[model samples]
Target: EDCPHREKNGWMGDAHLAAEMAFYNYDVAHGYTKWLADIADEQRPSGEVPGIVPTAGWGYFFGNGPAWDCSLFLIPWYTYLYTGDVSIIEKQYPSIRRYIDFLATKANEHHIVAWGLGDWCPAKTETPAEITSTAYYFKGAEILSKMATLLGDSGSATRYAQLAEDIKASFNRQFYRGNGIYGNGSQTALACALYQGLAGEYLTETVDALVNLVKSNNYHLDCGILGAKYLINALLDNGHADVAYRIVSKRTYPSWGYWVEQGATTLWERWDGENSRNHPFFGDVGAWFYKALGGLRIDEDRPGFKHVNLNPIFPEDLDWVDVHHESRYGNIKSSWKREGKHIHWEVNIPNNTTATVFLPLGRQGEVREGGKAIRQSIARINIIRETDDMKVIYLTSGEYTFTFVNDQD
Candidate 1:
């Protein structure tokens, strides 16, 4: 269910679509724990989770698909990632394994999942469930493989990892068209492939195609709740964060800014705002804001924000940004502003946490911290890498302010 005006059910698609934003904005993992228990306790004998939790024997046959069911696999993994506790994975291990087994039985010879809704309410284009669902099938198996590895079950890990690769092969055989297109040349399919790491070798080509696709649409988002986050990631991960910003900053049709301009204070059920006035399905943009603009990000290898990657990408037109988050470790802050040819950056890394901070600078520049030379700033800051336009440094928990004088750019 999307809103109280509608079914008000616990829709898995809505849950997982906003999972990232939820994790970053609030301490929702504890609350999600009991809900995850409900989801597992309500798992069907056939190993499929219903579209709605605590259902009355509905949503299993038609309302739910792999995309919706992915919350079972994806959310637990995210829980473990955000909390660094294996208990969540352990609690759902059996159900996860059984669900993947059931999915394996459902796949056709070509390993395509054509069941359930596909790309709910995409703007102006159709993406098949066969493509989207199977893509999620690959993701579920891939995540299971990693979870198995974390649990010290080598056999299951190898089995699921290999199964994921086989599913990938099947997906490419059926859906991948030449030159980085997935299915029907839709943004949904392309963005899914890029987000799930399905575009293994043609990653750059796929990113270029997505960029071209956005350009063709005049920098407006056409994806639904599902593809929006991944589309943002595909661009940000491939060095086109500016393009992602351009898409989200639009205030015309099919853009969130358009909704804001219309005197709306709540998220709409659709881009056109034709139905419900409050919805959380399209909240992934909040996560993008923290990651891309605020320079706050988490690492899989170092879960629970023990260590972080501060890789802020500057928007082409926006000259100032301020971001802060209270992660499990402590408060993390990053703020930057451009003044003429100079940049004033301030950051706060809480105690007992370390951060890898990246500074966007030109080849020739002078950097000073606390009004002192960066070289004399401390025994804490160490330059790891420097290049023509950027510098990378390692920082232990502390508050810092750095000023960069633009000499080359």
Candidate 2:
């Protein structure tokens, strides 16, 4: 149920968006895996997946678009990423390919498939539904290609890879113009293009335009439900963490802070609190705090957290952040604080696990671990790389304290 008081439907899009945060915050593998099985069982013969699994037969007749149907691919893919369990992918592969093939049948002459709910909720935007829908189509194909490669299905991998490339070319040809311009110049359209890797050569330009779009909106998000989840990440990935931080920390109408200001104890279904005040769909931003601000990430190559990556981003406005997660391997920890021009970072990597810690540094010779300068020959520590912005260090499982000075004034 999206909310206890409202229509208690199992909306697929909401589940897709909230899956990451749910896995990160809790152990939901058993329940979620069962739900995926139900979704697979309910898939219609026409290759159309219902927008809500275990449906009352309402979502099938309508609202079953790529944005809604994408849970078929995303949920299992994310499960594989988080848990390192390939059984879900193996089980869902047929249904996943069937859904993608169904979407292919909906493609226009340009090979851009577009038929779905663009961005649910009311917002001022000139972006078309086709852009968002087709972008998701491409995203699904891309993920499927990766899944095939992972499963050693070389033929399927090649097929889906080619399909993804074709879709990317079609998307760029249909929407992208010279520079950063996209269809309707809407934030959602641009975000999809950038975040979905459809921007190609125009990535930097698109990012700059996106930053300007947010600044033009006074640092307020302009995307609705579907695009909102990607907006913060797109901004942060494109060298605009400052803007991302500002948006998440804003306290006004159409912002998360607005809900907090209204004395609401939970994330609202709508940004305006127009409907159910307790919904977790739009709460994907919480994952960003853990990834970007708190700087804890599971290594994709070593999924199930066999290898941890500690890359904390210390925002200028934030003084300190503390984060911990209990992985199947062991407990992972990262705590950091800034006092004047110096930063104190403490990290704990569990036994039998290793980590690559990226410590922000202002200049060379500014980093010291356990009161000793980091060196290539240091025991259990190896300096991977050094740039003006950060010092990347590789460490075996152990507790370590590092200090660096901010030389920039």
Q: Top lDDT: which candidate number? A: 1
Residue 268 error for model 2, in Å? 1.0
lDDT of each model, Cα atoms only? 0.85, 0.83
What would the TM-score be for candidate 1 when compared with the true structure? 0.96
Off by over 4 Å in 2: 363-365, 376-378
Candidate 2: tens digits of C-alpha lDDT, residues 14-126: 88888888877888777778988988899877688888887868888687798888989998988887777889899999999898898988888777766777687634554
Candidate 1 global CA lDDT score: 0.85
lDDT of 1 at 36: 85
- Compared with the true structure, what per-residue lDDT tens digits does model 1 show for residues 92-133? 898999999889887998778887677887767778888888
Residue-level lDDT for 169 in candidate 1 = 86
